[model samples]
Target: MSGLLALLDDVAAIAKVAAASVDDIAAAAAKAGTKAAGVVIDDAAVTPKYVHGFQADRELPIIWRIALGSLKNKLVVLLPGLLALDAFAPWAITPLLMLGGAYLCFEGAEKLVHMFAPHADHEIEADFDTRDPARLEEEKVAGAIKTDFILSAEIMTIALATIESPSFWMQAITLAVVGTFITVAVYGAVALIVKMDDLGLHMAATGHTSGSRALGRGLVRAMPRLMAVLSTVGTAAMLWVGGNIVIHGLDVTQLWAWPYKTIKYVATELANALPAAQGLVQWLVTAALDGVFGLILGVILIPIATRVVGPAIAAIWPGKST
Candidate 1:
């Protein structure tokens, strides 16, 4: 009887250790996920554009395909690489992160420039409108997955960097959890955002009650403006996140702290001016500076990316250029 009791005690102890490990993973995952919020928001905001011209029925399926691709991008392609990096060359994380941040800056700044440039339409939509529907869908999904790869790399790196634990398996578990959660959240939100108008139209046309129909009509009317807002938010997020990374990287690389300090001063000034909106004002001031710096950096990078880096990449990859 005593031997059986001892065995039961050992089982209970093992269960407790398992529970503790699970709790640790959950905590780390949450921490890492929160740290990657900017990239996650940008991911969600950027995704809806891929399905824009598709038939309403095809939108969700396309998004599903893209989401699946995104999952594979992160898990199959990126996850293993990140783990390998962590195991072999953890020092490579920061520089790669900064490069990803620079790319975000370039993308966001390009959008802003297009908004003001007179010839924006010449290249903004590109040849997307000319392709066969199926081909276009496939291309767009591929493009989106490519884009997601960059963002996912940044997100995963950020998540990995934010993790405090020393155990490799624990870090792996946390990163996987973070990756799964963010992909679902981003694509799920993208699906909802892209379909809101159709849903509203359906509700307006087929709702059983007058109030329901009215609400549906309102949703349909609201969608365009909501999308515009999301685009603006996405751009801002990209610039803010990008600028923060470059500035932090600069500080890390022993360049200077003036940029960060200047932004902090501006944020403080803005906060002082708006007591009621102190937090918001501070955030906007910081974001605006970050965006401005990001734009400048992006402009500088544009010619290099287009004329130099782009061609070199095309040369290396041959058929893979976007």
Candidate 2:
């Protein structure tokens, strides 16, 4: 039985190695996912508005559909593309990242403008309001999925850049995990946010106890305000992430280093000045500068986008673009 024991020992050794590899994968995935937090936050925040006015019965199903679409967007379309790009043309990633950053800044700034500034789109927002449940649901789902695709692309690209795997298979698996986890987390939260009102209403109507009814009423009242806060936080996150990416990209390329360097230096000086609360000061300073940079870049791009890229896209796509 010596040979049998040797064989068992060998098997045990192989299992140990396999376990190590799995642990490595998990560790890398967690770190990479953390690095992509801003895009992920923006994604989670943006998804809920799509199901805002849908009928209660249809909300979960709609989120499910969009979640599936998001999975397909990240895993099927983007994962392979990222791997291929890494394999063939690694240099394109920084530029593509900057492009995605610009889009995020534009989207975030547009939302800000829509909120505080009355404009053509805001007027249309009230004018073309649909009351039909079915039509409105379809339009909202379609729009949400389209927006999710852009955010998902950003998430995937950021994850791909952070992954330092030895093989494409490893990168693909990690990305798939990040994509699936993020999708479930975002949509699951969306579903809860959308349904908490109905749940609260039902509790108020049916609960036998006064305390339960009071809690339910509070929940119903709190949800809308919570959503508004979440949206504002999401916008800030987008600007912070986008501006940080652009500035970091510029630094990486050695193109325009002065502004970012100045920001970094000021942040460091502030941190040093306040030693007890150094970390908080540093973070706040960095975030503020990043957001301001994002706002300026977005403002500059808005004009160019409206006058130049918008026209070129319409010319190329003919009927598809507006």
Candidate 3:
């Protein structure tokens, strides 16, 4: 009887320890997910466009395919690579993060230019005009997956950096959680966004009440505007997050101290000025400064990327010019 009681106590202790580990992983994943919010937002925003012209029946399947590809990118390819980096070349993480940041800046800047300066939509038009629907779908899915791979790399790296776990297993579990959660969230949102118009149409057609019909009409009208807003928000987020990452990276490496200190000083001053909204004011000031810095850096990088890097990549890859 005494021996049985001792075994029960041991089992209870083990259960408590397991529960604690689960709580720790959950906490770490939540924190890491927050840190990668900007990239996640952009990911959700960008994915819907890939399914834009697909047939109504095919939309969900296409989204599912892309979501699966995204999962594979994060789990099979990126997670293992990240673990290897953490194990062997941990010091390389910051520089790689900076590189990803530069990419985000470039992407945001390019979108800005395309938005403000109207250019020929010939390429897009031509792509849409293709005779082979299957080929077009494949190409679109492939392109989207490629884009997702870059964003996933950024998200995973950011999450890994944010995790505070001492155990390798804990870090691995946290990353898996982050990756699965982000993938499902982003693509699930994309699936909904793409089907919203159809849902609205159905509601308008079949709703039993006038209010339901009116609400459906409103949803139909609102989706395009919502998409536009999302795109704008995503661009801003990318610039803000990218600039902040670069600034912090530079500060970490002792390459530049003034930008970080200057931003902090300004934010602190604003926070002090508005005691009632101190936190909000400080965040806005910091984000605004970071975005401004990002815009400037992105503008500077645009010419170099287009003239030098673009051409070099095209030269190497032949027929893959952006």
**Per-candidate local distance difference test:** 0.83, 0.80, 0.85
Q: For candidate 1, write residues 1-322 as lDDT tens digits.
A: 9999999999999999999999999999999999889778878877777777678899899989988988888888888889898889977767777887798788778778777784754543654554678777877888788778878988998898899999888988888899999999999889889899988999999999999999999999998788788878777777777887787777676678789888888899879989999999997788789888888898788778766787788899985542
Better TM-score candidate (2, 3): 2
TM values, all candidates: 0.89, 0.85, 0.84
- Score candidate 2 by TM-score against the native: 0.85
Among the numbered candidates, top TM-score falls to 1
- Taking the tens digit of each residue's C-alpha lDDT, what string does model 2 give over 1-322? 9999999999999999889878877877888789878678777877777776566788889999899888888888888888898899988877777887787677678667777875735433643367666666766676667667767877887788788878777788888888888888888887888789888998888889999999889989988887777778777877877788788889888889987899999999999999999999998999899999988888777757756786789799873321
- Candidate 2 lDDT score relative to the true structure: 0.80
Clashing residue pairs, backbone N/CA/C < 3 A, model 1 = none
**Each model's Cα RMSD:** 2.5, 3.1, 3.2
For model 1, the superposed segments whose C-alpha errors exceed 4 Å read 116-129, 273-275
Mark the regions of model 2 whose C-alpha exceeds 4 Å error after superposition: 1-14, 121-139
Error of 1 at 147 (Å): 2.5
Give the least accurate 10-residue stretch of model 2, judged by summed lDDT. 120-129
lDDT of 3 by residue, 61-91 (tens): 8999999999999999999889999999988
